[model samples]
Target: MLRVLIIAQCALLSGVLVAEVSAADPGSRPNVLLIVVDDLNDWVGCLPAHFRANGYETAGAGKIFHHYQNHPSSWDDFWPSKNLQFPPTHVPAKEYQPAFDRKPRPRNWYMDFNWGPLDKVVEETGDWMSMKFVSQKLQEKRDPSADSGQAKPFFLACGIYRPHVPWFVPRKFFDMFPPDRIQLPPSKADDQPVAAGPTQLREVDAR
Candidate 1:
């Protein structure tokens, strides 16, 4: 029987293998569903609620030397990151809205507060077309009638690119973290300033 386990944790870890079929067998490998979110460092809450609820949050980069390695035996076959390709250039809409619908910032931002359903962000942004591709792959399921009436188990890995931009997250997410309720980083009196060039003074000062 095919069983599935999805590791929703931030780290790209391949957990213990439950079963190992013969490599020579036509059905040896488990059906793989891959997901790679580009520039996704912080926001991972876009995943299914159950997976997020039981997930283990870590720095995720604890070990630098062996971080992204996967067990060779985890799958008989595998595909590396697919969304590594750069996104298409974006053209702003004629009429623009800002986050919280508050006011559009002078600098263009992908996500600010024009909101709708959760998946609406994926639906609307052409730059984020990769999300729709991943969604379609997720929808494809094994047909029980085909394949000798036996359904093969699958190993699906879904990566949510929430923290990554163009931010385009739902409006509810913005409401969830209003400016007042947000936490600011503590300023340290002993913080040291690095040397910067005259040309980069404005950019460095902003930091």
Candidate 2:
């Protein structure tokens, strides 16, 4: 009877192990939430994109980091350049001028104006407007079951444009990093490397 009890216990343990393995398999797809933030560098508290892109399963505390990072085929697609329509007069002398110069100055039109308590006269109005617009869209897509009656599982992407100059963000975010407290990135004054080709030379010069 003692031998029979041992055999029964072993069988129960085997079943539990099998169940755990099945739950942990990668092929067993869970509800995927793909949040791709455009032009977002490795700055956020949850560096999800960096981990997933590099095949890192988890961070220090066993928290899963499953965000994928994607690169644009063309440089133009890197940012919503076309969306910010430039005036005819703003066009550069050269047909294919550098992207930095090609970008329209004074005002960026790519940002939405609606869905915000933003001041039109504020210098960082565009940034505030864009954040509000993106946030609203995120709530709509992610929390669809709340009021929209859409209960389907979704892969929602929340893209935010930031730390990209005109370095525009709301006053609250700006206030977080005071100029005196801000530590600038280290740069080498005389660290110029030779370019491999004309194309490489042009790219280096542009930078």
Best candidate, lDDT-wise? 1
- Per-residue alpha-carbon lDDT of model 1 for 23-45, expressed as tens digits? 22214432221221211212332
Count clashing residue pairs in model 1. 3
- Which residue pairs does candidate 1 place in steric collision? 2-153, 99-112, 99-113
Per-candidate Cα lDDT values, in order, are 0.31, 0.30
Candidate 2, which ten residues in sequence have the lowest lDDT sum? 58-67
Residues forming the 10-long window of minimal summed lDDT in candidate 1: 57-66
Candidate with top TM-score is: 1
Give the residue spans of candidate 2 off by over 4 A.
1-127, 138-150, 166-207
lDDT of 2 by residue, 1-207 (tens): 323332332223222222322333324423111121222233331243344344432211100112122322111221123233111111121322343243433223222111112112343343344445445545665564665553433222223333322222344655555769988777564653321122222221232
